[model samples]
Target: MILASLLRPLRSFRCVLLFSILIRIGLIIYSEWHDSRSVVKYTDIDYRVFSDAAHFLLNPGPENENVAQGPLKSLLGWKISLGNPYTRETYRYTPLLALLVSPNDWSHPSFGKYLFALCDIVNGILIYKLLVNVILPSSSHNAASQPPNKTEKHASGPQHKRDELSRTEIEALATTFSAIHLLNPMVFSISTRGSSESVLSLFVLMTLYASLTKRWDAAAIMLGVSTHWKIYPVVYGVACVSALSGGSVGSTSWHLSLVNQKTIRFALLSAFTFGILNVVCFLIWGHPFLEETYLYHLHRLDHRHNFSPYFYFTYLTYPPLVKQPLDSESLSSWNQLMRSPLTSFVPQMTLALGAGLYYGHRIDDLPFAWFVQTVVFVNFNKVCTSQYFLWYLLLLPLILPRFHVSRRQAFTYVGVWIALQAFWLGEAYRLEFLGEDVFLSLWMRGLVYVLGNCWVLVELMKAYS
Candidate 1:
């Protein structure tokens, strides 16, 4: 029975992977011709930095003991610039990313796209596996990603078995999820653009999948790697620790629960992995690794081309009153503190923690909780961008069937969300390119978009029981 069950999924995965690969290859080839003919290229400029960083690491001028396989020079502080790290020439992300892309051949510049494209495909497979392993055994089939209840797990009657998804139903759900992810235009193009968002999605889902299977050590490793790659996934730490405790939050005080042995085990392992990575890289790259990767993102201030509702407000407080560490001293004056862009982070974190606690308190709730958490995090962040949406987009497929909304309602909500973004894009185009004074108008649109997002969230909550 086990062998048959396993083979069925393997066959299903192979079919979907082949189809996804063909579609991506076609789009990538078309992009090569299409990009060259247009004013704007389909390949993002960020791709240049990723590819170049790889080649730079392959050979860094003989600084470390003349080691021939000398990627040790990759750690030199002077090799990459942290000042104005925003440019395509300078690498602003993790050293691990450089190593990941180091094997790509510069002879074929699109190699990074191909590499990220594979990550996108593998993410789809992980989504399928996640659905199959996690199940609310007694709930309706629509609730695809949740652990079986204790009663359901112990039950031996035919009714208990009947509640479980059959091979056919599970296969159907897997197909739908894989198709949703691989075929989504935004998700597809993210890889083609060569943004590492797909890679991030891979690690994030791997962590979630590992946790769902109760693979604590593996989950901790993946969570650590994901967090190190980009700091945002650290927020999911709350959800993970809570889920691992198995609704133990009620039996123990909050502090005690946080200090629970399970929590400590996961935390220490994850932190150790994170620390070892930084320490090894810091030895070579020096302080810039810490400053550029972590610090810069914490207080990042970019008002232009921003979609956050705080965009106009941040613009008003553009040049910060003072450049200082994020300490109580910097927040001494109410006037300065209230006006700072970082003030928006208060609500961003509050909503994220609230969502994480309410929804991520149990294994059954983790999948949807993660989706909600990511959406809330991205929506209210001081710096919001389209690419950030992919954080949730990867998990969006898992909980899609759990919602009870009609097709019409789903279309209405999605259409409104897309329409609001389109409206903002039009206003931004006029302000940036047409050089119109549309700041106030853009702010108004942004406010309405924020309200629209709220409405969608409320409707989703109501429909997802």
Candidate 2:
């Protein structure tokens, strides 16, 4: 009778939890609807590029614009605007995303944004599932072993036999973790926009999940699709190599290991598949796709102190040479300087890759996929904006189950990120007090950006080390 009474309340509590989750999902859907109707405004420069690419895809362009700038751009153009031609300087590198969202043009931009936002919500759910299914399993097992009641203890049995987790525990942990990801302000902000990052993140997480399950074929396909969306996902292949090489069978050292035959085969297959696709794109579109999509990244020089330590070197050593506003006749010099790598403060991207490889060996264990990805990303030569937090966020639940920072520390880190976002979003409270000095505002904002990313990097280094 006593046990039955206790079980009744527990069952009621579970029911309430399920109800709350359903309510939250409903709220998220409603919020997305409200946000979508808010506006069709560009929050960043990349938005313009993506929007232009969408237009180009739906309407063919002249020879200048018709030439493929990237695989995605070419693919989207072929899909949306088969015969007609259009021309614009605002061509983008990511046309696949535009293609995916193109079907919704009949509705307002809000509808498209809402669709993407829902995708983000789905991504958050997947992250939570990974945390429960992949990361928190061991923790849940541990928790299950220590029972509070005699009946619970008897039911669980000895510690040696307590490897499996209960469904309830798994669901609870998943729900908690999922909520964290769902409410993440950065994710919310980006998903509400029509950019590809949210979709890219979803694919990346799916790849990680597939890889964790040792479903190499599925993992490879997911990764291939992910890379098609954003080039950065290609680095994940290197991480896969590192993971498979860490075992005892073939080579003792990661540098020389070729242990797992299955993993090796899968990696090779993925590489071949992506390579073939690239070749096909090349054959279809030729040089424009190669130059504008692939090579364009090589020359991008954003004037901001991004997360990489290299940004500090560029900002401090060689400031960007801005030309005074002038007539069109004098524009050639400006363009020449902008295109010159010698004048630009390019970071040593190669060195960063080498360094990441070195450190990754020290930190990554068993399923080294996420660890290797995080290490490589942190060391990349280019700027690491706030949205790139998704890279780390996806991996954290996988790699850091045993690790626990204090609640205070977690809150402090979140607070810093919020402050940094405020500055980046041009909502700096300090700016309100400081008035119209552009230099002061820039300096203050830049400092916050540098510090926030640096703090994250430092935390990552410590965690991995």
Candidate 3:
């Protein structure tokens, strides 16, 4: 009864949403104040790009406006030139993003920031729903099938009823889900800085929620729209389709049939929706939309701020005319496994597809499936940035409660993760800011960071699955 009393108020989502709003208001004020005092503003550059694109679209000017420029060339033998398609880092997403934030130009400057914060809160609310509708139900089903405990065998009334979670406990867990997403440092900072990831995250969860509830069309359309908005979520369509085609946990198995009606329908509808969006964008933005938004990302090569395991290779293979902070004669002795750019694509796709098929085979594990798939995709990606981490972080909390890791084990993994990151950042700082030749050292640290990530992934699999 004491525990129940403590949890009762937490179940009130209305109160939770109110608290989130108040916190966002405070964050907005704090961010604006901080930016006013700083040399560089706290607002993300993407926000500026979005505003510029909107201004250009709303009222055409006689001059040419260059948004982003990609002059990167291939590292080794392949002369993969991105050829100054964009002049600077401008709006590189769908024109609809500019449309969403265009109101900021005429209205308040922080209009888009407010929109993203609201979406962040909505992402929290969706996680709460996912916990209630999908995760908790599976836990309860598993509990019911197991043998009863001493409390269940000896007690009367509610205690003996399947030994399931009470309404109060479920509500508390849902509120916990909200807390994890809304209050997380990484997630909170990204949304407050005016990135559209919060918006993208909302659609990802919406697609999952819609699919688990057996709303096929809603799921398909949601998936399509999110993919159009940002390309990463398209990988999740595989997991959703896998979950739909498979059966319950114990009886889950793979089979092939021409008339597996549900998956076929889902696939066709999603493709149609995506194709329609592409056609519409093509008419509006011409070939530039296809080139800049989609193809640019595919052939993206970040040689300067590179973070992948292939970073050193990317750096070493730069054209001889390009100046390096330090000559890497020692580094030249190491063999290059990849002679060309885009070599990582095969391994990335293979692992991602394998994870989708394996975890999505069990409907009960769909959240885990998406989380693992995103982690693999981001880790192996050719160009990884700070924001890309949010892709998997959005799905992490849904499966966290089930992880069997003890506090000590969890802390150890977290400490190693943070330590490795600090080491990489420190080494990178020495090379970039101090004009030191720490490139080789930074590359070695980058390899260690990738190893650290793999360790965490293995631990997560053992703890949760």
Candidate 4:
């Protein structure tokens, strides 16, 4: 009776949250069973990488001794034999994963699946809070034009409307976030599939929540940690600094004083926190650590299972090359350009810089602008993994509610995006699993992905502009 009374406040969502948890638990059990039986484990590649690193850290050998020295040693013409700790293998994740999993019996296959599921739950709850608090309130201004009852009449001014979400609004917002994060099949598939994207998404949500609450130092610190987990969150650091500056949201007027002492203080703290962790990693594992964790990502361009828009370029130039193994040393100079570090680096930088500057200037609405900037950053990323979709998916509840779109328009927009994803995945399935040499179709799918992203961006502009 007491539990029922307490859950009555959450109303329908109490059941929803419980059901979501059950669904995730079921998925985890199924995945564990599948892993035990299947000869070719699907998500085993990434899980093995993390678990191997953890085991290595827990039990080092003579092979781990030849840690590479600084690049300056090579520049100074010193004979430095960089040990291939992971000669045919690579652990591209940060040491934080190794640290977290090493002590917790990560040797077991179920540990990662369980950890990811827990993080997925955390993400759902965080998204719910963000919606009920930050986003719904910012959107209430449009509703403010309507007549408020006696209760709302006594309500505080526009800035503080966030403090007063009605029961119905709260229920609706809770339902939306819970349904999106908890009930979405994509979330289930990713978590059960043993992707660490769930953990990354949780940190991203926490960082967003802190920024929304104007906890500058807290937001900065979280962003730094999240970036350490995965390099992509570094892009959101710009949004963090912008939010801390505390200018009016959605405004074009730029403030020279925006770059003030408080901003600098927070920025420095964030940098120090971020730099210290990476430095410690270097000290512990030496140059090989940095190379695998950081450099490997920049250099990775797999034509085999690549779903990036750049794949189209590779297809057009060398259709046959898609089937070849990833022997970087054997590639010709022109073929190397197809997977060149410069190719992805320059464009990603340009887009991120432009988006950061544009949205950073307009601070009429920090949360919304942050969402736009984040989506823009991901849209422009060189390597768009399917799982990376969660980075923006978790934020959509906040943005979509605020967007003044018609029901039909919203449905159409979502349908188009899903269709694009489905088309790409279908092609990928044919090639990767069925052994179909549908290289040309894969190129078409990449083009469709690009177009779909462009459409989404256009709609975002319409909503904000």
For residue 55, give model 4's deviation from the true position in Å.
Answer: 1.6
Task: Report how far residue 16 has shifted in candidate 1, in Å.
Answer: 3.9
Residues 1-465, candidate 4: write the lDDT tens digits. 999786554456667678778888888787767778998664647776766666655554463354344443445654444332343266777767765666434356568778888888887778777766666665565555455444443332232243456758665766655677787898878877777888888888787778778787887888888887787777766755665566654556545545878779877887887898888667555677687888877756555555576766655455435456546566676777776677876777666655665565433355555566666666556567776777777776656555555556667888888898888888889998899988878867877787787887778667552
Ordered list by TM-score, greatest first: 3, 1, 4, 2
Clashing pairs in 3: 67-88, 68-86, 68-87, 68-88, 69-86, 69-88
Model 3 Cα RMSD, Å? 7.6
Give the C-alpha miss distance for residue 174 in model 3, angstroms: 1.6
Quote the positional error of residue 116 for candidate 3 in Å.
0.7
Each candidate's clash count = 3, 7, 6, 9
Model 3 vs. true fold: TM: 0.83
TM-score of predicted model 4?
A: 0.80
Evaluate candidate 4 by giving its C-alpha RMSD to the native, one decimal: 6.6
Model 2 ranges with Cα > 4 A deviation: 1-51, 61-88, 106-111, 139-165, 248-252, 258-264, 304-381, 415-465
Candidate 2 least-lDDT 10 residues = 152-161
lDDT-better candidate, 1 vs 2: 1
lDDT to native, each model: 0.73, 0.55, 0.73, 0.67
Select the stronger candidate by lDDT from 1 and 4. Answer: 1
